[model samples]
Target: MIKLLIADDSALMRKLLQDIFVAEGDFDIRLARNGAEALDLVRSFDPQVITLDVQMPDMDGLTCLSQIMIEMPRPVVMVSSLTAEGAEETLEAIELGAVDFVAKPSGAVSLEIDRLRPVLVEKVRAASKARIRRTLRLTERVRHQMRSAVTARVRPKPARRRPVSGAGKPKQKPGPSALPGLVLIGSSTGGPAALDAVLPSLPGDFPWPVLVAQHLPASFTGPFARRLNSECQLSVVEVGNPMPLQAGTIYIARGDADVVVAARATGIIAMPAPARASYLWHPSVERMVLSALECIDAERMLGVMLTGMGNDGAAAMKKLSEGGGRTIAEAESTAVVWGMPGELVKNGGAGLVRPVDDIAEAIVELVGAHASH
Candidate 1:
């Protein structure tokens, strides 16, 4: 039996979680009513996977998570609310080494959390397979990747030369706008924190716009974009409707649907995801990449597959690559779950494999080369 721990402040919530997992029939469930109890049980139960609630009395989930990672790093799946604060903290948990998160379906005390039963079970299963690393080792690897990226050759800025005036004077102005085309990136599971590592590395003058479609709930995506915008130099916004694409901006798809790119005589436009049964992830990575191929030439686009569960973008990325598109897969060394990118690499879709911190450099190289042509 797979040893599992369920920790929450509410007795009702603990029993509720227990009942849900009990139905799965493969887990040996243990319960903790508070963080202190969870800490004690960590040694007694030695759970293989832990489902930890975000808010708890005495010691909160974040604090408990920090301690857990330090003393006994094990796979953790956060139970978070579908609210701004919850999303923010959940992302932090991922950065802290949690395998993934589950959105606690709308209610403080309602049984509606049961609505997440299917996803919760699957995530727990996935979490069990996660490789738990010590905090020091993980941090060092991330720093190394970032350092390597900075030292690597990347996108070249357009030459800036002053224009000669009527006489002998010269006038200075901002550099020319970034080249045409788009960069599409997709991820799930560990995506939030991975995105934070990558996006901030791309400068404000990054050539071509970026389109992102991560697996997120409607309530979380908006706040996620806002949070990303605060950290990254690029202007980030949550896509609401069809809008003209512009340079140096990153548009994140609405959580409930896909964001598709369509070519118009005027320019490229972003629209809501169309209904497609083939997709499993909400803002389906495959659907978005395929739709983007219609507007941006495959040879000019860069398709990046980041950490996530399943092969959401693998087939489409392979297709994109066959048509001369540049592709990258997040390296397993850094991936929280390498399923998506691992599939892509297995299918020969990616030309390069990089860690999350090094992806911005890869993007710059591909886009800059494409632009120079």
Candidate 2:
């Protein structure tokens, strides 16, 4: 049975969540009246997943999260009110190692409870299985110290061109049947499972380089990449500084960094920014798509918007479409949350709407068809 600890100050909210989970019939539930009680239960009960309310009487959820993550790490889903401050704090909770969350509904208990059931169940499942990592603040100082030590031990090398793969083969003008130069994909929320379904279907020697941005907590992205690499045929690695893009390899953006694909004379540059502040979401899909557009012209680029909550990628997909690039948005039935890709389709940004299973094949065919012209 999945063990869950529901911590909230409001008795009704806690009871509602418990009812939702219990109705699902697969959970062992524990309730905490406040953050302090939750902490005590976390120590004794050792629950696999925790749902914490942001505002609490004794200790706030953020403080509880900091302590829990440091002492005994586990997946935490922040139960936040649907207020601006609540949203901001919930985002912070995500940054601080909470896996994900659901916005608490207001008014009409029956209706709100019904509306939240699906999201709550899904998030609880994802959180239960998520591999929780150490909070970034605790590790940042150590990481900084380690970085300084490493920098002192190593010497910078001169910039050299990375050789393009499969270059030695005789130039065969890729007839309209060849794949494009690069494939750029952006996703959030339910992206990992979607990508897992889509990526492994492509052949091992897939012709185009694949770049992806999956909105995720920094702590989760490393494990997420490992999980994808284990399941997929293609070699997947978390994109780091100065990593050169290579065909047949998939580069996943590390959380907390904006992933931008820049073209160079030798090969593609995987540009990562450590402190990008302008965008609301790190690894912003808009930034990634715009950068890809700069590197590969629209016709040679393929943009994909997958399931997510917000409209982060919609604007950029529009730019890509206007630039003559083909864009695909995940269909509603296939999406866990239809907010992101749904916006793209509604706004006329997407050139095609396809199921998750057909995305890779569609890209291959679309690029191949273009190459033949």
Candidate 3:
């Protein structure tokens, strides 16, 4: 059975969540009223997963999270209000190693409770099996430290210029019916929402195979892919080793593996990292982009970086831009947390920065233009 601990100051919230999991009949649930209580349970119970609320009288979720990671690391799902401040703190918690989060329900207890059931259950299950990484805020001091460490460890590569062939270039072609060469996407913190906005826009007849690397946990990817497949026009599935790439399909990397496109005669194959090779976080955006750049021609690749935290994709996006791929970043106004895409823009790695809605349209336009050519 999956062992779970629910930490929240609100009795109603705790009871509501407990009921949801109990109904599922697959979980062993524990309860904690505050962060301190939760920490104590964690040491003794050693639960497989934890759902920690943002606000608690004894200790805040962030403090508890730090202690949890330092003492005994496990998957944690932060529970927060839907306010702007809540969102900010929730993102911070993620950076501190929380796997995912669920927004606290609002309005009438009955109405809100029902609305949150599905998301809560899903997040709980995902958190139970997620691989969490060590995270630090991307402050100037932290960046300086990282830069120094990187500089001391490795030599910098020569600067490369962004390719301009596709810029303002009209789509011309042998015919209007050719298939898409490749589809590359990057996503971070708010990637799920961004993807929800974009993936469904592609028609069922889309000719390109889609590749996505979302910064998420292993447990989340499977359910996430399934959810996308249900909503999207195309078939969406979590990628596994030796899976053949096909048009009208979306492949999400497993949460514990790097998603890479491997070259093949018919098309690219989805390559997942071996278990031993898995990073603390899987579906690494950087590794995915670099591998895609090496496997496919730039002109044939469509690279997109969506809302996220951190600069994980910035360096690889530079390669994509230089390789003549069409690279796009999520615009700041629409991002949940602008850290990742912002870094790409600051580094001049993005060819275009567009809002979430426009991203889908832009992709279609680019693909259409490529087909025409």
What shift in Å separates residue 274 of candidate 3 from its native position after superposition? 3.1
Worst 10 residues of 3 by lDDT: 157-166
What lDDT does each candidate get? 0.79, 0.74, 0.73
TM-score, cand. 2 vs. native: 0.57
TM-score list, all predictions: 0.83, 0.57, 0.56
Clash totals for all candidate models: 1, 4, 5
Best by TM-score: 1
> lDDT by residue for model 2 over 134-167, one digit each (tens)?
2124344223333443675242322222222223
Which candidate leads the pack in lDDT?
1
Point out where model 3 deviates above 4 Å: 1-179, 275-281
RMSD of 3: 16.6
> What residue runs in model 1 are displaced by over 4 Å at the alpha carbon?
107-114, 132-179
| Candidate 1 per-residue C-alpha lDDT over 332-361 given as tens digits, one digit per residue, 9 for 90 to 100 | 987878899999999989989997767888
